[model samples]
Target: MTSKNLLTALLPLVSDLSRELPERERYRRLLEAMRALLPCDAAALLRLDGEWLVPLAVDGLSDDTLGRRFKVSEHPRFEVLLRSPEPTRFASDSALPDPYDGLIEGFHHHLEVHDCLGCPLFIDERPWGLLTLDALDPLRFDSIELDALQAFASLAAATVNVADRIERLALRAEDEHQRAEVYRQASGQQSKELIGQSKPHKRLVEEINLVGGSDLTVLITGQTGVGKELVAQAIHAASPRAHKPMISLNCAALPDALVESELFGHVRGAFTGALSDRRGKFELADGGTLFLDEVGELSLTVQAKLLRVLQSGQLQRLGSDQEHQVDVRLIAATNRDLAEEVRSGRYRADFYHRLSVYPLQVPPLRERGKDVLLLSGYFLEQNRSHMGLGSLRLSADAQAALLAYDWPGNVRELEHLIGRSALKALGQHRERPRILTLSAADLDLPSPSTAQENPASQLQTASSVAVAVGDLRQATDRYQRQIIEACLTRHQQNWAGAARELGLDRANLSRLARRLGLK
Candidate 1:
C-alpha cells in the first residue's frame, strides 16, 4: 500500500481499536504509519514522561539513546522549539545556542539522523510529546516533504488528543456527564431573534444566516447595543464548533503589559506577579469560538501577534518562546468602522484585511424598522413576570414613542427600557404579577426637546478626551454599559422606579442590563 495508503488504512484499524488500544500497541502502530509515510531510516515517538521524554518507539537508534530518557532541559534544539511556533530545521540548527554543542556530534553521523525534523504534539498549546524523523543524509527533505510531515504530526496530535480525552472522561464520568448536560442545554436554547423587520435587519440576518456555518474570521460592525456580540454568538453556535465552549474576551479591556498574557497565556514568573502558569483565551477556546469583542481596540504590538496566530494556528505563552498549536473559530466584533480606524492609523492595514475576511454588519436598533415594537413586546412579556406584573400591552401611543425614540443603545438598550417600564408599573415591593400600568414617560425616551436639551452635555464626555488611542471604541462601550447598568440597580429591580429615577424607561432598562454581566 502507498504511504498515503497507510493513513486511509488506519481508519478501519483505529475503529476496531476503539474499545482500547493498549498504549504500547498505539505507539507501535503510529510509528509504523510514520515510517511508511516518510521512508525514514530512523524515527522516534518520544512520550512525555514527567520532566523527561522517554523514547517510546524508534525505528533506528543506538540502544543507549533509543530507550534512554532525555531531560528536556538538556536538549537545546527541543527546548528552543518549545518556545517557537516554527519548526526547527537542521538548517536552522546552527542558529540555536551551543548548550549541546558536542553532546550529539558523533551520534548525528552514526545514525545518519543528520537530517531531522521535529514536530511538537500539542494539546491546547501545551507540549504533550513530539514525533521526530531522521535520515542518514544531510538536507534531504525539502519544503513539500516537510509540509507532509507537519500535516501528519497534526493528525497524530488530534488522534492522541481524542484518545486521551476519552480515557480521562471514563475515569471522570461525573464531570463528563455534567459537561454533556451543558452541551445539551446549550443545544436547545434557540438563538435570540435579530429583532427587526426593517430592510437593514432583514439584510443583516441574511448575512448572518448565510455565513454562520463556516469557520471564518468575521468582523461585526455596528453601534453599541446593536447586538454585535449576539451576532458573533449566532455565528459560533451555528458553526461546527458549536459543541465547544464559545469563549469571549474584550481586547480593549487589557493593556500592553497584560494583553499578550491574556490571549496566549503566561508561564510561571513570566512577569511580575506571575506566581503560577495560566492559559490564555485562545487555548481556552480550543476547537471553539474565540470572540475578541472590540478587536479594533488592540494595540499595534498585540495586533501583530494576533495576526501571526491567524496566519498559523500556533501560539507561545508570554515569557516563553515555545510555540503550541491551537484550534479555534475566531469571531471578532466592534462597533467602530475598522476601515476608518485603519485609514486613520488606529489599526494595522494587514490586520484589518485579515479580520475583514468576512465583514458582517449589524444594524442599529433605529435601522431595524418594526423590530423595535416586535422586540419591545417580547421584552415586556419576559420581564413582566419579574415585575410581579401580568402581561403588559403596548398602547398605540407607547408604540409610537418606541419608534420615534433614537435607540442610541440598540437592542440592549431597548430591552432595559421595556424591562424597567414593567418593573415600575408593578406594585413597589412584590414579586407577583401586577396590572401593567404604564405611560409615555415610562419608556424614558426623550422627546425632541429632551434630545435638543442634552445634545451638548452627552457629547462632552464622549469626545475630545484623554482616552487610549487605539482602544477608544472599546472605552466607549465600557462607559456606556456602566451608565446603563447603574440605572438598573438604583431602583432595586423596580424598572419603573429606576426609569423614573434616571428619567428613562422601565422596559429598556431590563434589556440593556446584560452589559454588566447581569445575565
Candidate 2:
C-alpha cells in the first residue's frame, strides 16, 4: 500500500479504539504501519513491563536476539533514562560517553546502529518504558523525522497506558461494583469503604479488609488529603464491630493537658471547665474503632496514657481515677516521619512499633498515574449530578491542564476544584453546557518557573511554539489559546472564580478552550 493509502486506512481504526485490540496484534499492526511510514532497518519496539523491557515487535533482527529477554538492568542505555529525563542519542562514533556501553553483545553487535533515538515513555513524569529505534547505516534521523517518530512513540505510549488502565479498571470496576451492590443490598450497611478504583487504592482496601476482621492495630501513613481518615472508616465498617459507632479524635487539635481528659473520659470537676461527667472517645467506641488522626502530635503525657490503653485495653478516667476496661480497635494516622521521631525521642519507640502492626501507606495523587483523569471525571460527574446538571464532559484543553497541574492537595484538591467549577457554572446559567472547561487561568495556579525567570523570553517563546496550519479556524484557535493562557496567569488558574469574576458560563468558556488545540 502507498504511504497515503496506509494513513487513510488507519484513519478509522485510530479514530475509535473502543474495541480493544490485543497487545500482540496492536504491536504487530503498529510495526507494520510504521514500516510503511518510515522504514528503518532493524526497528525494535520495547514494551515496558515493570523493570524489564519485553520486546513487543521487531523487524530486520536475528532470531537469537528475538528469543532473549532485554532485562533493563542488563542494558546500560536504559539505566540512565530510568534514573533521569534526558534522551539518549547513539552513533558508531561519538565524543561523549554513550549509555549503550555494554548493551550490544554477541551476534547482535553486527547490526551497526549508526543512528538511534531513545525517549522515555512516561505515564505521569515517571518512566513507564523506553522507546529505542536503530538504523544499520550512519546518521539517519533528522530533527523532523525524530519529531515524527517521537510523536508516533507518544501515540504508542498513550495506547499502552490506556490498555493497562482499562485492564486494571475492569478488575477494579468488577470488585467495586460487587462491593457497591452488596452495600446497596445491605442498605449502606456493607459499605464499599474503600472508594478508589486505583491499583494502590484497591490494594490498600484489600489489605485493610483482611486485617479489619482481626484485632490488629493499623497505622495509616500518607500526605495530607490522601484520605487516611476514610481508610480508617473503611476498616471499621468492614470489621465485626461494624454495628457499633466509630469515634474519632485529632491528636493535633487538642491542648496538651486537655488531650488526656478528652481521651480517657472525665468525671465532674475534673478541671475548671468539667461541669459534667463526659465519656471519652474510647468509652464511646468501646466496641468499635477510635481513629486517632495526626497521632504523632500526642504529648508525652498523652503518649504514656495511649501506650497503656493499647497494651492493656484499659483506661483510667480523670478526677475519679476509676479504672475502666474497653473493647475497641485503635487506628492511628500521621503524615510525620514517626521512625525519625522515634530516633529523636519525641515519640515512644514501643508506641510506634505497636501502631504499625499493619502499615498501610496511601500513594499520592501523582503516583496513581492515569487515575488522575479517571478520578477527575468521577468528581466532575458527581458535582454535575449534585447541581442537577445534565451529562457534561471536560474540554480537551481543560483535561490536559488538569493532568499537567501538580496536585499538591492530591484527590481532595481535585475534588474541590471540580465541585467549585460546577458551582461556578450553575450560578452563571440555569442550563448546563455539554462541556466544562478550565484553562490554565482557571486552574488558579501560580506563575510557572519558566515565566518567573524571564517574562520576555516566555512571551517570545509562546508565540513560536505552535506551528501554523492551513485553516483560519485553526489559527483563530491558536490565538485564543494564548489569550486564555495569559488570562490564567493574570488571574492565577481560578477557573470558575475567574470566569464569574469575568462574567461567563463554565461551558461556553470551555468550548472556546476546545478550539484552543484544534490545529
Candidate 3:
C-alpha cells in the first residue's frame, strides 16, 4: 500500500462523511476500501459496547459473523488490539486463538487464520472500537506499512463520529450522555434487543419511538411466541424513566388467590401463606415502568381491582387499610384479543380501554420474511458460544427451509428449533468438527407441500374424533387432552417446549393439564 493508494481509499470515506449514506452502508464502504488497500482475505469493523465488541460491518466473513458479540476478555487478540494505540500485527504462529478461525467466507473446510493485524480506532481521544484484518496465508501482512494502516484507522474514526452525530441529531429529544447511560444500564441487566430489518419490524419501531416518550399505557398484542414481552421492554427502554427499574410480571403464572397479592402486595398475616409483609410489583416499579405479561389471563375480579389502581394511582395492599400512591407507566402484553373479551364480558371494558391507549402489535416470525435468517444468525451465535463450537452456520438449503416454514409457534419456536437442531447435528458427528453446518435435514421441518397440507389433515382427524365422542363438551376435552399428550410425548415431557408448540403459556398449559387430569 503506497501513499497514493492510501489517499485514494481515504478520500472516498472522507467524501462519504458528507454524503448522508445509511450507517451500515458507510461502514461497508469503509471495510471494502480497507480490504482493497491492504489486500487481506477478511476484514471487519466492530463497535465497542462495554466489554463486548459488536460487529458493524464485514467484507469477507460469513453472514452469521455479523450477529456474533465478541467479549473483549474472551478474545485475547481483540483485547491486545484494543489496548494498543498504534497498529499491531500478530505472528503467523501466535499462541492466542483466532476468533475468525473457520469463519472465513467461501471456505467449507476448517481453515485457521494465519496472519492477523488490527488497529484501535479512537474519537476525541477515547477508544471507540477496533478495525481488524485476517488472512489465511502466513506473512500476508508482513510487507504492509504500519503508517498506512494508522492513517486508515484515523479516517475510520471520523466516519463513525459522523454517523454518531447523525444518530444523536435524530434523537434530539434525549441528551446523548443520558442515552448512553441508559444503554449502559440496560446492557448490565442483559436485556435482549429487537433485531429485524423487515418493513413490519421497521413500522413497529416507528410506533414505539412515537409513543415511548409519553406516559400512556401500552397494550401489546400478538400471537403466542411473537415476542410481545420484548416489545414491552423496548417501549420502557425508550421512555423518560429508562434510568429507573423496569419490573416484569406474568399475570397468568400464578393462581387467582395469589394474583391480587402479587400485584398490590400484602400485610403480615394477610392470608394463610402471608407470614411477613411484602411489596408488590406496583410498589417495586413505582418510579419506573411496570410490565404485565399475559394480562388477559387476569380474572374479572382481579381486573376490576387493577383498573381501580390504574385510574387513581393509589393501591391498598391485601388486608390493609393504608393506601399508597405510585407513579408508574404501565405496559401490558397478551396474545388473546382483549376487544373480543370485552364484548363477551370476560374482561372489564374500562380496563380494556385504558390499556389500549397505545397499542403495539408484534409481527409473527413467518410474516417477517428474511428476518428469520437474521434471527437464526443471532440464535446460532448464542448456541455456538454456549456449546464451545469453533463456528456454526446454516447451509443454503437450511436457510430456504426456514423461510418456507409457517412458523406457527413464531420466534420462540425458532429459537428452540435452532438449539435443538444444533445439538442434534453435533451428536451426528463421531468427533466435534471445527465448523458445524446445519442442513435442511438437520432442521427436520416439514416440506413446503407437506406443511400446507398439515392443517387440513389435522382438522379432518379432529372432526372424526368429535363425531365419535357425540357431545360438544366431551369432544372438546378429549381432543384437547389427546393433542396435549401427543405434544408432551413428542417433546419428551419438556413442558416448556410442549407449551410453545401448542401456542400456550407454560403455566396456562399446566393448569389445563391438571384440569384435564393429565398432570
Candidate 4:
C-alpha cells in the first residue's frame, strides 16, 4: 500500500477515537483498521488480565471467542506475543498450537495457520496486551511493513487510554448515586439484630465477631432463604469499613450476559441496549464492602474476571481499558456446593479458593430449635406495625406448630407465613379484635413433623415403593440421588461429612453427584 493511501485509512480511526463511540466499538473499528493496513485474513485485540489474555475485540473469530479466557501458561503463542517488544511472525509449520485454531473465519476446522503476525501493545512503557493478525496464505505477511504496524499499534494504545479516561468520568457520578442508595438500605437494616439464644446461634455470632475485624474475604454458606444476607450485614456492620456503604448484588438474579457488566461497570454502547455508561457494584463499593449473594451461580467467564478483581483490587470496566484501583472487603454467599461445582468444572478452583478465605455456614431453621418462637414474635410485630394494629401474638397451638414444623424455606418463609396468617386470622373476625392472634389453623403448616424427622423421609418412602421391572433402574437412581442429596444437606453440603455418613469416598461421591446432576 502507498503512504498516501495508508494515511487516508488511518485518518478514520484517528477521528473515531475522539468520537463518542463505545469502547468496544472503538476497539472493533481499530482492529478492522489494523487489518486493513496489514492485509490479513483475521485480526483480534486482547487485553492483559494477570496471566490471561482476554479477548476485547475480534474481526474473524467465532462468537464464543469473545467470551473465552486464554491463559498464557496454556498458550505459548500468546506468551511469545507478550515477550516480544516489536512485531513478531511465526513459521507456517511451527509446533506451537494456535489459540484461534478452527476459530478463524472461513478456516473450517483448520488447525495450522499459514502466516501469523502479532504486535505487543503498551501504554506508558507498561505491557498492556497484544494485537494479532493471521492469514491462510503462506507469504501473506512475509514482506509487510513492520514499522507501519508498530505505529498503528501505538495509536491503538492511545485510543484505549483516552476511552478509559472518558468512562471513568461517567462512572464517578453513577458510583455516588449507588453509594447513597446502599447507605439508605443499610440504615433500614440496622435494627434487624440477629435473634436467637440457641447454641448454633451463639456459635455463629462468635464466628462473626472473630472474622469481622479483619479484611479477609468471607464466604457465607447456607440453604436458600436462610438469612445469609443477614449474616453478611452483621459482618459489614462490625468491620472497620462499616462507616462506608455496603453494596449487594445477587449473582443468580442476573442473566449470564449481564453479570460481568453489572459487577464491573460498562461504557455506553458496549453492547446492545446499553444507552448509557453505568457503574458496577465493585466500583460502587470501593472503600466499603461488597456482598455477592448466590455467587456460585456466576458463569465461569464472570468468575474468572471476579477472581482477578479480588486478587489485585483492580478492575477495568466492560468496555474501557483503564484499570481503577478499588478497596473493597468482599462477602459472598451461596447455597450451592461450590467445592462440588469446582470438582465438576462448573466453577473455577482458583476463584473458589480466593472467595472462601473465611467460610461461615449459617445454621438452618430446623437446627435453631426454640429460636423459631423468637423469630415468630419478630415477624408478628413487623406485620402488626404495617397493619396499624396495637399488637399481634401467636396462640399456644400456633407456637407448637412453629416449633414442630421444619422450615425448609428458612427465615424468609417464616416471615411470609406470619404475614399471610395474620391477614387470614384478621379477616375471619367481623369486628377488630383487641390483639390479633394467629392460631395453628391460620398457619396451616404442611405435615408439621415431616421435615424434622430424619432428613431422609422422602428417600425412605421412595425406597419402600414398588417399581415395575423395567422402571427399577430409574427408581433406584432417584432413590440414590435423594439419599446423597439428603446427606449433603444434613452435613451442610460438606463432602467429607456426607462421604463418612454414606460410607463412600469423597471424590467418588462428588463424581456420582455430578453424574446425577446434583451439583
Question: lDDT values of the candidates?
Answer: 0.65, 0.64, 0.85, 0.79
- Model 1 segments more than 4 A misplaced: 1-193, 427-433, 446-519
Q: Which runs of model 3 end up more than 4 angstroms from their true locations?
A: 173-188, 447-519
- Once superposed on the true structure, which residue ranges of model 4 sit more than 4 Å away at CA? 1-190, 446-519
TM-score of 3: 0.82
lDDT by residue (31-125, candidate 2, tens digit) is 66655555555556665644556555555543223322444654566666566554566555743333222123222233323666666777776
Enumerate residue pairs that collide in model 4. Answer: none
Q: Please give the lDDT score at residue 348 for candidate 1.
A: 96
Looking at model 2, report the run of 10 residues with the lowest lDDT sum: 99-108
State residue 59's C-alpha deviation in candidate 3, in Å: 1.9
Question: What lDDT score is found at residue 207 in candidate 2?
Answer: 84
lDDT of 1 at 248: 89
Q: Per-residue lDDT for 369 in model 1?
A: 47
For every model shown, the clashing-pair count is 34, 8, 0, 0
**Best-to-worst lDDT order:** 3, 4, 1, 2
Question: Per-residue lDDT tens digits of candidate 1, residues 1-519?
Answer: 345665674564456346577555676677777776676556777766455665655555432233234556656666765555545566634543321211231332122124666777877878878787666556565533566666667667776776667656654433433444454467665334344444566677667756866687888887788888888876665566667988889887888788898899999999899999899999999988899998878999899999999999999999888998999888898878888888899899999999989988776665454667667655654564344332354544566677666677878888788777766656444554323534577766654322222547656655543264447666666656655555445323545534443455656666655554554
Task: Single out the weakest 10-residue window by summed lDDT for candidate 1.
Answer: 97-106
Q: Which 10 consecutive residues of model 3 have the lowest summed lDDT?
A: 446-455
Residue 124 of model 3 has an lDDT of 93
